[model samples]
Target: MTHRTTTGTAAPESGAAVPAVSRTDLPGGIRVLTERVPGVRSVALGIWIAIGSRDENPDQAGAAHYLEHLLFKGTGRRTATGIAEEMDAVGGELNAFTAKEHTCYYAHVLDEDMPMALDVLADVVTNAELAHTDVELERGVVLEEIAMRDDDPEDLLGELFDETLFDEHPLGLPIVGSEESIRGMSRDTLFDFWRGEYTTPRMVVAAAGNLDHAHVADLAAKALTDAASRFPTGVPVGPRSGASGLLRPRRALALRSDDSEQSHLMLGVPGLNRHDPRRTVLSVLNSALGGGLSSRLFQEVRERRGLAYQVYSSHASYADAGTLSVYAGCAPERLGEVVGVVRDVLAGVAADGLTEAEVVRAKGSMRGGLVLGMEDTASRMNRLGRSELDHGRQRSVAESLERIDAVTPEQVSALAAELLDVPLTAAVVGPYDDESELPGALQDLA
Candidate 1:
């Protein structure tokens, strides 16, 4: 179950690996990405498993996240504490996280400790001793995680948006499962999931910092040589085709006093997905609208009117569904005005689109940003791995550059019209006593 290694053209043609654009394949399909930094003595290695919250079934909502915790508990040769001892002994730090679509385990270590780091990661992932006691202990940790998200209004808003957007689908479920579902998780359950999905070919062991590709692959092979299995042959599922909608726009406002500076408001609309052809144009469109400080929303709302300290608009594209979002922080009294200003900006942009100069600057910022960011090993690994997950084989940086460069003002305008026209679902947490205006605000979208 190994794949052919591919190196994107983002790296310098010479031996110097520009950040992580250089991709090299190793035996067993262990991929390599690198960022060659001058005077640096270490490299950051990431063994990214192409599995995450979205991969969970109806009964295994939190299995991916739960498995992430257990991977560090113990392996065939080292205890959880011992794993730490070894990394600490070598001045290396290790950690992992489970995201909506993938789970990543990473380590930053000096040049000499690469072998040991690889071993520790491999033992934990391949030979985890997922004991019942470890599973029970970690279950509490995950529950705390769930509680934390529930307490934050902004977080809850996103959760609601997803639930509403994908009403009857898994795409809308939270990354961490519900309390009851998390409690139902077991060791055998995670093991079964891991065995089925965590095949050698479906994963990438990316190393940057200070290391060689051949050596890393050799170590990875030893650690994961036995991990050969046929990838599940399920038919590809298509994107959501039903009428896109969100949760009931109810007045759910919760304000608790805790010496806070400003309230955070998370407003969202249905967004596009990764496979959409309009993605490149949307990137530039989002940039001009609310991507950074110099955007239209910031200029109109903050600079001109001084309504809020922060305001931005952006989109999150996925494999099936997406969400275009607006985030802001402001005084309780100014929330209404801020909401109005955001709506006006969206309406204006959708109708008139951005200026030629605005489009140029946005694309320039995006182009320069992409060129500059790919100068690291971890970044290269992430780009290649992520694009591969979405578009299959790694695409050249030149291809990405051309795509972003080809975005026209008309394209951006059309996307804004489509996305902004969707219903606006918002979640506000602050001193918002007057709930009568929310309906008007929601109707103001587009």
Candidate 2:
């Protein structure tokens, strides 16, 4: 959903073992990788094309997304309805998504239906009619999606942060382009983008669970053999030159009209890029900050202060850059105190630093969580594919844990200091207008 393309970071290939999945180059330039995970009844296959919102020029806003919809409307061999019915008949779940640097269509199905899933997915990507009629109808649906995001307070605020952070870059554009751009989109424009972006060499076909090298390779050969099309080499993506935000103090309030029980407040700042070696250290630091019920923000804000029902911190690193955010929900009456407790914990970590015991607990939590999560086939498959996308190859679970273990308390403390040093950009979605009374409202931290 978000584009994380960054420059100078190590391509994911740096630390990864050659994946267990065998890789092959097909006729059209598509690359396929497959691995067999035994004893699972289901198979998961992904068609990952290297096109996302970040590739869009401002003029083309949601063209990639529009193309994604047309892919399923009708392929040469399958009608739109037929595509859906055939998959459901076999209890197969098919889905697709657009992100900053990739568009992925995936399926989870009984092993026997793997071939069927591939045929359907391949057709959707390569043969959609993109007829004027289908395009016109879907445009309305997409517009409604745009409206929904604006109404969703928390989501809208994050979008605001991204927009402000990457003002002139493609990263600032929403995945679902503006209404004006979507309305202007023509079938030909959709076709041109697809023809230029979708190709065998630029694609990744990854399948895991109840599948083998032969089956995956065969599927890849059939679906991707004809996908080759070439374009000029891309110029590298650049860093965002924009400042952190547009929310001026005593200006218009960034509240949303949600009649829900609690109000949500979110604060964030730039963090690190995906390939940064200290990512593991950042991870440990994030967990200690507000990752769980036992986390510092949770302990101070929710348990002790009894202001917020929830509070958590997260760090997201992209190829080009990263972000660290803290989000919380609380009653309107308690918002001020909730903000105070959160600030206290943040300031405490940034100033005094994480204790030896705290760092150990965070490390155990992060490393232990990784080992426990890879047990499921779907999780394992996605982990591999996303890691490949973000980092190049997948790190073995043991290797991931080793990195976590190597993160010293000093590293975490240092990262905590770095992340908190910025003047925080805060977005609160609730009933308040001009929340000048927020605790720790002054931007200073550490």
TM-score of 1: 0.83
Give the clash total for candidate 2.
10
Off by over 4 Å in 2: 1-19, 229-261, 433-446
Measured with C-alpha atoms, the lDDT of residue 133 in candidate 2 is 89
How many clashing residue pairs, candidate 1? 16
lDDT of 1 at 253: 33
lDDT (Cα, tens digit) per residue for candidate 1, span 248-327 = 32322323332344656667766766767788888898899888778998898899999888788778876766777788
lDDT of candidate model 1 versus the reference: 0.70
- As a TM-score, model 2 comes out at 0.86
| lDDT values for all models | 0.70, 0.71
By lDDT, who's the top model here? 2
